[model samples]
Target: MKAFVFPGQGSQFVGMGKDLYETSPLAKELFDKADAILGFKITEIMFAGTDEQLKETKVTQPAVFLHSVISALCMGEAFEPSMVAGHSLGEFSALVASGALSFEDGLRLVAARANAMQKACEANPGTMAAIIGLSDEHVEEICKEVSVGGKVVIPANYNCPGQLVISGDVEAVDAACEKLKEAGAKRALPLKVGGAFHSPLMQPAQEELQEAIEKTGFNTPKCPVYQNVDAKPHTDPTEIKQNLIAQLTSSVRWTASVQHMIADGADDFTECGPGKALQGMIGRIDRNVALHGIA
Candidate 1:
């Protein structure tokens, strides 16, 4: 069976979907629709914006979603999958691709999510860091030791073997990074993010997004979507909605999700997004599985 995966943030670039926009009429039509729905020329920013401009949470989220979903649409009859999964914000794109959500609805959700997250960030300053060459347990222990007196920190993204991202208050994250390095991590590099995602700091964002999510309509998906919150495949609309609502404060179990997919008979994995980060992570998770990329 084949599994289609979508990448989240940090997968975007300046000229992400320009080629597709210029080449395919279908892609252009979708891009135009996105611009109208977003109330601005997002296509202009996506095609010619600077790195800093595209890095804004609002632009980054929907820009990546558009590139991924439109790329899948451009695949036409070839874009078939036994199952689908996405990392963080990419979940919206996966839902649309799997027929669980309409394209316009997905874009609107992404935009709302991004704006809410940004607001949460501005309200409470925080950050994230990447820990390489450390066991997940070891990193978790370090985070626990460093987090105290409301300085909340926790493991955020389990990217692959020996690679995990931690998120929390800026001081707590920095202290955790130091301890993780002392615990024999190869590198504890801080990420360029505005706030601590997938941690308690995002509770405000979660609360804000919950209303939008509940208001949006979700149809039965064509295939099961392995959600980010629990790394479990969910087909029911209610279950999907619940998982999505909880995902803002839950660790993204990418490694476990890929393992579950492989165990469930996903032999061929195709990454549908701007960057090849998911492909690389899946490769490291299981070398025996075949890998392909759409963008």
Candidate 2:
């Protein structure tokens, strides 16, 4: 079976969709539609804007979504997947690609999500860190230990074996990194992110995004979508929506999601996005699977 995956934020670049916009009519039309939908020329920022401008949460989220979804859609008949999954913000892209959500609705939801998250960041300041060469259990234990009193810290992304990202208040995350390094982690490095995502700090964002998710219409996708919240495949719109609601405050089980996909017979994994981040993570998760990318 084939599994098509989408990447999240941090995969974007200054000239992300330039080639697509210049080469494919469908892509050009979608880019124009996105510009109108967003009420700003996102294509300009995506194609030639400065990195600082592209780094804005609002722009980065939608930019990555457009690139990923358009990359998959432009493939036409060749884009087929028995199952699909995406990382963090890429979930919206996956939904649009798999036919669960209309392109316009998906873009709207992504924009709303990005805005909400940005607000939550300003309201509750926090950060994230990458813990390398540590077991999931170790990272979780260390985070729990650091999250004392009213402080909050937790494992945010189970990207692959021996690599996990933790998110929480800046002080708590810094303390956790100190302990994780002492626990034999090869490296405990802070990420250059605007806020702590996939942690309790995002609860505010979750509430704000829930309203948008609830109001949006979701159709039954042609294939099952393995969600980030639980690493489980879901086809029901109601179930998918609920999972999406919780995704902001839940860890992205990328390692487990890939494992489940392979266990369910997905041997061919094709990534449709701007970068090969998902492919690299999947490769580290399981080296036996055939991995490739569309972008």
Candidate 3:
């Protein structure tokens, strides 16, 4: 069986989806529709915008979604997946690809999520850091015990073996990094993200997104989508909504998600996005696994 994956933020770059739009009429049509739906020329930004412009959360989320989804679109009959999973923002892309959400609705939700997260970041002013060569339990324990000024830090993304990302207030994150390094972690590096995503700092964003998600409708997907919150597959709409709502404050279980897919007979994996980050992570997680990239 084939499993298709989508990448999250930090995988985007300048001229991401330009090639497909310029070469395929189908891709062009989709790009035009995205522009109309987004109320701006997002394609221009994605195709020609500088790195600085694409780094904006609002632009970054939607641009990466468009690239992954459109790349899947251009694949036509060749795009087949027994299971699908995405990292963070890429979950929206996987939902659309699997038919759980319509293209326009998915894009709208992604935009709303990005804007809400950006606002929450501005309001909280927190950050995230990458901790390597530390057990997840040790890292989490350190973050929980190393609070400063009553601020909280927590493990955020489990990217791969020996790699975990922590998110929280800037001071708490910095303090936690020092502790992690002292705890024998190989490296404790701060990420360039604007805020402490997947942490309590995003509570406001989660609350705002709840309304948007509740108002939107979801359909049964063509295939099962391994969600980010739990890294499990669910077909029920209500359950999907609940998981999505909880995802904002939950660590992205990418490593576990890939393991589940492998155990469930994911013989081949394909990453559809701007970068090969997913492929690399999946490779590290299971070297025997076959992997491919879609644009």
Candidate 4:
């Protein structure tokens, strides 16, 4: 069996969709439709604008979605997945690729989600950090101890065996990083992210997104999707909705998701997104795992 995975943020770059836009008529029509739907020529920013322009949360989320989904669309009948999963924002793309959401609806929902998250970030200032070479339990305990007085610091991304990302308020994250390093973490480094995603800080964003998610239509998927919140394959639409809601505030169990896929007979894991980040993480989680990229 083959599993198709999609990357989240931090995979996008300038000139991301230039090749598709210039070569494939299907890609061109979709890009043009996206520009009309978004009410702006995002293609301009994606193809020619500066990194600063592409980095806006509102733009980055939808832009990455477009790149991944359009690439998958252009794959014609060659793209098939026994199981599907995505990291963070990539879940929306995965849902579309798996036939759970229509392309138009997916793009609209991604735009709404991005705007909501950005607004939440502006309302509450926070950040995230990467802690390398620390056990998951050790990192969780340290974060819990450091997040005293209603401040925030929690494990956000379980990327691979010894690599975890923490998210919370600026001060809490900094303190946790210091303590993690003191506790023998190889490196406790702050990420260049704008806010603390997948933490309590995103509660406001979750509340805002709830309405849109409920309003959007969901259908039976073409294949089971291993959702981020639970790291399990789900076929029911209700379960998918609940998981997506929880995903905004829960840690991404990517390591566990990959393990589940492998256990279920997945042989080829193809990453359908911009970067090879997922491939690298999957490789580290299980050296026997094979990976392919669709970039």
lDDT of 4 at 2: 90
Please write out the lDDT profile of model 1 over residues 1-295, one tens digit for every residue. Answer: 9999999999999999999999999999999999999999999999998999999888999999999999998999999999999999989999999999999999999999999999999998999999999898999888999989989899999999999999999999999988888889999999989999999999999999999999999998999999998898999999999999999999999999999999999999999989999999998899999999997
Query: Which parts of model 4 are misplaced by more than 4 Å?
Result: none
Cα lDDT of model 3 by residue, 118-234, tens digit: 999999999999998988889989987987567999899998999999999888998999988889999999998999999999999999999999999999888899998888998
Per-residue C-alpha lDDT of model 4 across residues 171-231, encoded as one tens digit per residue: 9999999999999999999999989999999999999998899998898999999999989
Off by over 4 Å in 1: none
Provide C-alpha RMSD values for all models, in order.
0.7, 0.5, 0.9, 0.7
The residue-by-residue lDDT of candidate 2 on 1-295, one tens digit each, is: 9999999999999999899999999999999999999999999999999999999999999999999999999999999899999999988999999999999999999999999999999999999999999999989888888888899999999999999999999999999999999999999999999999999999999999999999999999999999999899999999999999999999999999999999999999999988999999999998999999987
Better of 2 and 4 by TM-score: 2
Best by lDDT: 2
lDDT of 1 at 147: 89
Error of 4 at 178 (Å): 0.3
lDDT of 3 at 179: 85
Error of 1 at 261 (Å): 0.3
